[model samples]
Target: MTDTLLNHHDEGPTTAPPLLLGPSLGTSTALWDKVAPELSVTHRVIRWDLPGHGGSAADLIGPGATVADLARLVLALADSLGIDRFAYAGVSLGGAVGLQLAVHHPERLESLAVICSSAHFNGSKPWEERAETVRREGLAALADTANARWFTPGFTVPGLVEDHRTADPEAYAACCDALAAFDIRERLSSIGAPTLLIAGREDPATPPAHLREIADAVPGASLTEIAGASHLAPAERPEAVLAALRGHFDGYALRGMEVRRQVLGDEHVDRAQARQTPFTARFQDFISRYAWGEIWTDPTLARRERSVITLTALVAHGHYDELAMHVRAARRVGLTPEEIGAVLLQTAVYCGVPAANSAFAVAQRVLAEEDKTEG
Candidate 1:
């Protein structure tokens, strides 16, 4: 059974959070080639091939296969890799499988991103017809239309087209059978995982409306539409797709925490974390994701400049405790005691004498503590 699991490519550190990338019906792991490496920097990215699409055995799925069947195969692959729960992002049929996991196997999923997919694929007629066509004449005819169906006009990835051309006709038809039967709209509201929908603005197969429908139904789900892309957005517009997936996976939290540690020092952050209670956890997350992640991590202003501004703001608000913290942060960002004094003196002129007076007292105490430790 381990050998019978879907073929997959794994990247990134084994200790990092697991993220699985699923491919469209006729595509394979190659579909994520452009984006997975970058995502792997912060996540353990594992992209898999559909049965017979890439390296997997053609018999892994059969003619009457359902999206739920595919979801189970995905779980088998994760289990083989020692992963119990994972974030998932998939395109088209792949996305449908992700939805199946979120709805049924919620405990195995951390989050989901459904790209160029729908809860229900229009209806069964078109897919049924396509499946029959492939069973009779093979994938050549459909493969010829891959570029037009998958991307905007004049944009073609030859490798993807080749993947479509080479897919096992029986397996491709079975996948179509899965799509034809897939309709999870009634259960959309029950999905509890954090969900994101990425739609290709130019996709003719599963248009932005399809993604929007999922967004509207799934609680707390968000939608993003990518211009100049079609069904295979990750292949056609990888950078945009990468950005959306990264944001959905909370890449900001990882980047933000690194910045927070640098600005506040490990001792301060660790101490604050030690004191964090369940009641204050959400507020702490906000500070990390918003204050440190988005604003402080912005490169427009250097850390030193931000420290100065933060100090002034704290003085203006008469927040002595926060001011004391920033005064220490100021030194970490390379502000000399003299520079700190200069900024506080300017604050006295503008923020008022009393506010600056209080700020100085706090800064003096922090500096004295640091001197004692250093000496």
Candidate 2:
């Protein structure tokens, strides 16, 4: 898009928190049409057609532009629009961009939700070759291949594939470059914002394995897998994906507000209420009532137990950052070293040896820290 082509498609009330949505590679913002309406119920949803797709200009940063650069551009767009901070969600290329933003410009985000994206697109040669083909012959050349990875056999009807394959070739190729250069495994630890990682069980491209890697890297990140869906989980199973996003973001929003209140005090929250920035104010109402008042306040589980459950789920699913958060929370909940070890050992069988190995190392470090503090 043009330097100033920050198109804003507002759907909800002005009082709602703005959700900046990034689209997957090879597809325009139209890919979010179904999900956006549901999200708009509580959020002022803003979807963008990245450079070279939809009405946005093509290749504004040229062919060599990395996904990080695209992230910077999106942040710039938010800045220009007076959005000091906002929640973000993305799929595929969009998810990669969201990852970069969460790591690099964390202060500019309240929460992040990534779907069908990986921190590292490793262990696959076919994807690389297909990316190369798109970079040369264009997206149409790999239409069949892309369809196979994006949707399940049943969902890959002729009409659906054709619709997905209609993306702009140049934009799709640029996205391929972004994907090829994307790798944020090491930087995931630096992401401070709460995050949700969603994967399609049937996603052949960025499969559950890749999603596990992302969850493992980003501290305290949550993961949810949608059964019987493909790479286009948001589209193929919009309800499941939307519910996950809504629930996770809602919880984050509530918890963050509560924490802010505790740390900053009620006077601060009241002052914030009076002079709240557009970005902060919009999320306060919905997040406080729904996220904190409803979900977080549920009496069925103690926060301590909930923390352990959340962490255990992440560990079992190979979400490292989330596991780390839970590890820290475990200490807070008075879980002994032996108990933490037991959790990791149990997770090893369910999540796999390699993941369990990493979890053990993290648990050991966290426990060592606890010992030092107690000393």
Candidate 3:
């Protein structure tokens, strides 16, 4: 648990919330290739390989292994990266591990997504048989069969097939062994994190019924079933998968940029966006997500009301640059110059005449510039 994990593939702003992407049994983190790029836009996407898959070494699995053991490895991976809390989405065995984390490490996960996974996995006998077959005949024994079960007919993935073909038999078998004793149906209701279950209609490996079981058990959980998709919905129907993911991580960014653009005007927002570089990216994301998304998007008060308060505070605090920006934004969101002048007049009484005087000067300059540009 203390040892640091290696070769974790990460994307997006470090300031964004951490999002863990897990793969099915025998598959590497490559399973999420189709879904990660779009999702990274709203999150710090962290994808890792299972023990013995891809760049990951099989050091965690052994006799009597369970999903709990795999879950601990996931936690250790997060800990090594200094991620205390994260949203998780996984496929098959990875989804089971997500469920395990939601059950045991509830506080550590912000949200849970179980894709093409099950609670009992049909009592593990199927898993044990698969494990024994791989142990005796090696990876090929399961690869040929698992490939078909993983994807619908007429859809073949060479890289995914190669992943199963090259995986260590023992490690792959150990993963199956972990599934042998896994069952958490009773613990479903105890999960507090928001949960989403995605099922593939054609996936005989773990169909809609399995995801339904999870949805019905977990409080406030929802289910989505994709037609014509087998176990690999993210790969088969990438757009649909991305849509579901965007919906799941919707709050991470909180739709703040839209409001910011609406309030500040497109030209102002375009300039702010153009100014972003690697050094300022995280700060920009922070302001956009929290300041714009959380605060600006709040419906408790209208944008105009918030604008008046913001303009007044900026003027009172002597933040002339910000006050100027809000003054323009206030005009954009429909506050007339007279209304803005009244707010500044009120600010003069409480925050002092000098502050209001300076604010008026800044506002006058911005308004004159706007008129000149229009003309």
Candidate 4:
């Protein structure tokens, strides 16, 4: 293990907006090679290998390690790099980690985008069994099985197949453990950051049903499913994945900037810019233009209404970090705490009581903070 923290391999201008990327299970940062260049045109991209996978050290937290550990590690990586906040885009296990981060560390994320992922991975027994096999045998044993879910039948490329085959076996097993234990289905509604959920229509591993479950659980979560792609949507259908991420970040960045200006005022924005450190400056323009500009200026809905809708959606879907932010935004938009509670209670019936139960806890904390600030 390298004592030094992981560093991002940058493609474009160092000053562009930063996007920290998490790769799929069992693969290295190279998984993003084809997609990162296109995204790098406008954003500074960071692609890193997960611990015990790729170029990173081979120490596992054992089968007992939770997905939250991955989330915390990623966050630690960001902190080590001096990133206060940045956009996050993840695939499968990576996406699940992103969701957890958005819920638990809202202040550290500007936006989140998940592709070919699910909020829960509990019911898939065969998949778990196969993973255990890889843990014992190696990745080669599951080559055919992994390939089928990763790419569409008609579009198979020999090179891509080889890439999948050569992946680290222990890393793959570790990821399987991460996925098997993942059960954030009940907590999707509490994520407060703007989110984009992309799925492959033909994906068998994480079917469209699971995607719908995620969308429905996270309030205001926008979903787009690629018709021909399967589980490895990023690799099999890079163009679609790139376009969705670009559009999402563009929209989210715009909305966030507008809100910052409104709340912090123009002078504050300017003063913040004047005093901006290199680390913080990387995200300033991108956040202002995209998150605040596009999302905030859209005439389709008012900020307050959007806030309420977003909060309701997250609560219904179970994304707590984003849920917390929107709850705060709901207050800023004039929604009463009671109204927010109503949304959670209503979501309980539609999304389930477990989700609602967790959402209510986040709501209470958010409301309490608001009350303290006012008092």
The C-alpha TM-scores of every prediction are 0.73, 0.65, 0.76, 0.65
Please give the CA lDDT of all the candidate structures.
0.93, 0.75, 0.86, 0.76
For model 4, residues 43-102, the per-residue Cα lDDT tens digits are: 778887766665565463445467887887787777776677889999888899898898
lDDT of 3 by residue, 158-217 (tens): 788889889878888888888889999999999999999999999988989999999999
lDDT value, candidate 4, whole model: 0.76
TM-score attained by model 2: 0.65
State model 3's lDDT.
0.86
Rank by lDDT (best first):
1, 3, 4, 2
Q: Whose lDDT is greatest here?
A: 1
lDDT of 2 by residue, 257-305 (tens): 6754543346646775897677875567665655555555667987667
* Candidate 3 segments exceeding 4 Å error: 1-7, 253-291, 294-325, 328-375
- Model 2, total clashes: 8
Q: lDDT of model 3 at residue 354? A: 95
Lowest summed-lDDT stretch of 10 residues in model 4?
1-10
